[model samples]
Target chain A: MARWQPHASERLVAAALDLFEERGYENTTVIDIAERAGLTKSTFFRHFPDKREVLFGGDTLAGRLADGIADAPAAAGPLEAVAHALEALGRETFTAERREFSARRGAVIAANPELREREALKGLGLTAAMAEALERRGVPDPASRVAAQLGALVMTLAYERWSDPAGHDDFGEAVRQALAEVKAAG
Target chain B: MARWQPHASERLVAAALDLFEERGYENTTVIDIAERAGLTKSTFFRHFPDKREVLFGGDTLAGRLADGIADAPAAAGPLEAVAHALEALGRETFTAERREFSARRGAVIAANPELREREALKGLGLTAAMAEALERRGVPDPASRVAAQLGALVMTLAYERWSDPAGHDDFGEAVRQALAEVKAAG
Candidate 1:
């Protein structure tokens, strides 16, 4: 039996990040994270499958992107639909308040091979999710896939800038700038 | 002491693929692969770092793509350079003789999660390699990256067609067609 805890997931994530930075990802344990979060092991498991998953939001981000694309203007072109979804991400997931945490998370994942692999797989999933959303909107095969890939590139570039410590731009601005550069380059 | 073995790497890869298809990847061991190839475990280690790597060419494909891009004509644009590299892949790595083996390898990889993750990461590496090669050719930042991304998509589409058992087209034909479709989509 597990007791209800407020913000258990967020607490666990923050605790895991702290522990991972302090003692390294491999040196830390699930129990250590749970204890650090002031929650039991079961409560931690309820939110995440393993220690590695603490930093990843599972399918939440993918779902949000898909919904955003689905809800884009009916007449929007493929890339425009993708842009709408990315803008939605800025307002929702990549909010300004999450900038510092995202930068730290990126650094931690970059330092670990396993985390890097997970990140790579997660990225593919996000691209697939966006492509599927486009397809459901009647956007056709290669076009939908192409749009998703370009959209993903835009997101990556925007994320790099948004999460940079020296950069002061919001996620939306970063996304717009990246989208313009990608459009020009394409 | 390790003795020089003739075509040891190729033999090991073939044996590993056969064993993986017959008994599954997890059930097969490095020793089984070596023995099946009539080679010693030392020969296997000399070629690959682990069992998972037996299916992956370990940066060989990336190196080839980069080399091809670097060797492209000075008059070629970024996407044209990528097309040139992909055509080279058809003449070299994805030759007709290797089609059956590549198809089987892709099937084996698609059946397993671990292999899929490795494949995803390898894809990112290939994209990065092409981008760097383009940059060395004086192509700018976002342009190089965009071209690489589109090139990767073309390669993926070409691979799907080239590796299809029922498809009669050559790898070069597939590359040309995919490149055209990607251009249209873009």
Candidate 2:
């Protein structure tokens, strides 16, 4: 049996991902993951709602984007506010220390169609959160939604490029380039 | 006993959605759906690969958008091409006759989280097809993706409002309104 350790949640996530990679996602269960992490099944539940949530969980990123957008200047346009949010989140969320983790997570997600669908849903959830934040700022219906989606699209494009192991551009620069491309397309 | 139907495919989809609603998505099975549709299981298989596909399986909308973009004028820029595709598809795909079916489909999708995730994936798939079409016309990576996503977002927003029974805007009007919003935000 594995021993109890510090940062049990992190250890559980690392161990679960490792098991998912080694044994395939469908074959891995919460019980199996819990045993691998040397924790009780209840402990696993305390950390994440389910085995699937272990990988796709976390409202932190959404919260970060929402908070970032909410902090934008009062007079900024919807798209401009969204840009500020993306930049703020990109700088704070995609730090150098987390690149490897993000890359590995990306690989795990890319390898599974179910995971890809879940990931896409997560992206839309982020978009919805951003849209709601824009709406709270008094931005109107379709405009707020479209602007938020454009911002999310740029952020997603930047993430795919930035997560490549050979990628040279950091997350913030990649975001800027993507935003520029959006403007150029327009 | 239910009699065999001429429109087996449409019958299967209608049956599946009905069963999904009455019995809850998880409780409904292929056999139940097929029997309710007055078709053999094999007939149901011919129409849809599985029960889930009955709700989430059409690519007709994506194909329409892709073909629309491919046929856009050479002088049209990426964003302009995207707008053309959205208008073209909206005109052809979201016809008045399909409004009731579309509204029922939207309700079914909203009632289930798994279906909602699949819907998002379908939206992204449409975006990818649009992006590929843009690339065929020589638009670059992020620009093509951003423009395609913008068009899809507008289409999605338009579809949601247009599907509402109380909605007054025609499909084309909603599409035009959404596109205008995107332009304004840009």
Candidate 3:
């Protein structure tokens, strides 16, 4: 499985995370990550543009989630459609092993102000993309805005929970709980 | 009016915003702002820690907003309480003249990655403060999370609208629209 090209990216990420944990994000270079992954710098560069990108490999998750929302069954409402897409992505992106890595990556980003800003920009971009996707689906004014905003909020809360040790629940469960909380409060 | 200590801070902020717009945030120095405000450097320093702090003079808006949420009347639920608090802060902090300054400041922040990260950090801090306030008010698990997350989302959306030329609506109105949109989508 590790020999495959598709898995190569994952291997680079795993290696980068390990190196980042061992040495700080600033201290860990592309060569170090590549060496740890048993690959060369060229292979590492082939997968990611830079060391910072390894932590953000999940960038494509937003586009995929948008596609899911767009392709959702007609019966599903906008929020429901977006949630379904996010849940599917959550399952695939934040697996048990990946949760540990994800938590570590989040902590690293939080500690580094630059990384944290980049992460926020990425989140904002995803929200805009989701909004565009909803609009394309003919979801009108406030529906598109609401879906995008709510989706981003859910993601923020879910990520917060997923990153915290006290928050033992899975991302999907956390999102569900957050939504339920919103309804109950209302 | 400008002789008062409270008014001095406002004056310094006004001067800084003027200088920032005239010269740019990077090029505008503390001395330049102090001169523009017709105040000594000592007076300027007393009001703000530095030139950048002037642009972000309302950093305490978040804490004030949190306090508002904490102290809202029992009739309002958590979300309503949070929304009311935000509205109150908008009335006080986001004046008509401040809107134009805010739009320019947002552009400055957006163009610079470091400034953008600092903005994100401030936003995260505000959200955490809101969450803590809600928790203290006996808002349970998901309710507290959702209230805080929604508060942040509404704030972000409102700021986005207020910053855009086409988004002529007031901050409070923008927030209301964002909340309505969410409800409509849901």
Candidate 4:
């Protein structure tokens, strides 16, 4: 097999996760990750601001999701719109390799309390941004919030399933099943 | 007003919150909280394991909710059972004064990333526990996870409402409204 050049961002994340697992998150530095990625500090900084950003890496998914929701048909209800947005965004954001990487990243973050909290704050921020996007589309109060939150909740549950060792389905299927279960319970 | 003696735990929490507000969470020592509560260090230690516990001492809400779900009538569906459990638990756990205190506590936690992550972990743990309880009740595979997560999502949305300055309704009402909106959206 040939050595393929990975995307700069992907290479940075792969390097960070490897270093974090080997030396622990607190012990690993940005320079260590940059070197491991075979990139200079400047290239690493271009992709990510700091060590934590390797895990967070900005809100690209949230922006894409917001755009999807905004472009959804006006006839669609808030929940449907948000759900469609989540589904589309999941396809773009979470590839098979990305799924494995994210699961590993989640485990590392979960092991540390402060890192876990930061992850939670990130989740909340994304949810808020999604809600704002829904509101901008004329989705009214409370419904906008609930739709955004529910969309995120389903996405999370689906991701957890997709990441599980026993989980073999695509993220879109997991999300559909989760939503169906919710509808059934309701 | 007549001075009423509070239980050691209650007194300790009161002192901790007061000192946290006055001197900041990092600046206030355990000893300072103990002295303000008119208790010995041992007494404070007996009630709380650490400074963070004082802020998050009421996790029993999850256990209470699980118990309620376990005891719910067999005729009720999983969602209904969880909703009833939440309504009962909300009334018991969130009194008017407690609501105000909780809102303030949330604000304080939001200001600190570490505290916010701890709060998120606690919430996630509670949701997982609830999912397990639902499984025990024969709620089945995806339904169990979906119901538990949706319940938590409703609680989260309700919390956002309850913590808002304009939010004057009880927690139960807020939850009910959130659920209704979700159902409507679906």
How well does each candidate reproduce the native contacts, as fnat? Answer: 0.81, 0.86, 0.50, 0.40
Q: Score the docking of each candidate (DockQ).
A: 0.81, 0.69, 0.32, 0.29
- What lDDT is reached at residue B174 by model 1? 95
Residue by residue across A96-149, what tens digits does model 3's lDDT show? 566777788887888776687678778877887888888888888656766676
Highest DockQ: give the candidate number. 1
iRMS values for every prediction? 0.9, 1.5, 3.5, 3.3
User: Which segments of candidate 4 are over 4 A away from where they belong?
Assistant: A1-9, A21-31, A39-50, A96-120, A161-178, B1-6, B23-27, B40-43, B96-100, B103-114, B156-178
lDDT, residue B149, model 3: 69
Give the clashing pairs for model 2.
Answer: none
TM-score of chain A considered alone, across all candidate predictions = 0.97, 0.91, 0.86, 0.88
- Consecutive 10-residue window with the lowest summed lDDT within model 3 chain A: A177-186
Q: What TM-score goes with each of the models? A: 0.96, 0.88, 0.75, 0.79
Evaluate residue A45 in candidate 1 and report its C-alpha lDDT on the 0 to 100 scale: 87
lDDT of 4 by residue, B31-95 (tens): 99989999877777777788887888866877888997898889988777788887886778876
lDDT by residue (A1-186, candidate 1, tens digit) is 548999999999999999999999999999999999999999998999999999997899999999999999999999989999899988988998999999999999999999988888898999999999999999999999999999999999999899999874589888889999999988
**Model 4: per-residue Cα lDDT at residue A67:** 94
**DockQ-superior candidate, 2 or 3:** 2
Candidate 4: the clashing residue pairs are: A117-B117
Give the per-residue Cα lDDT of candidate 2 at B106: 88
In terms of lDDT, which candidate is stronger, 1 or 3? 1
Candidate 3 at residue A131, lDDT?
81
Number of colliding residue pairs in each model: 0, 0, 0, 1
Q: What is the C-alpha lDDT of each candidate?
A: 0.93, 0.83, 0.75, 0.78
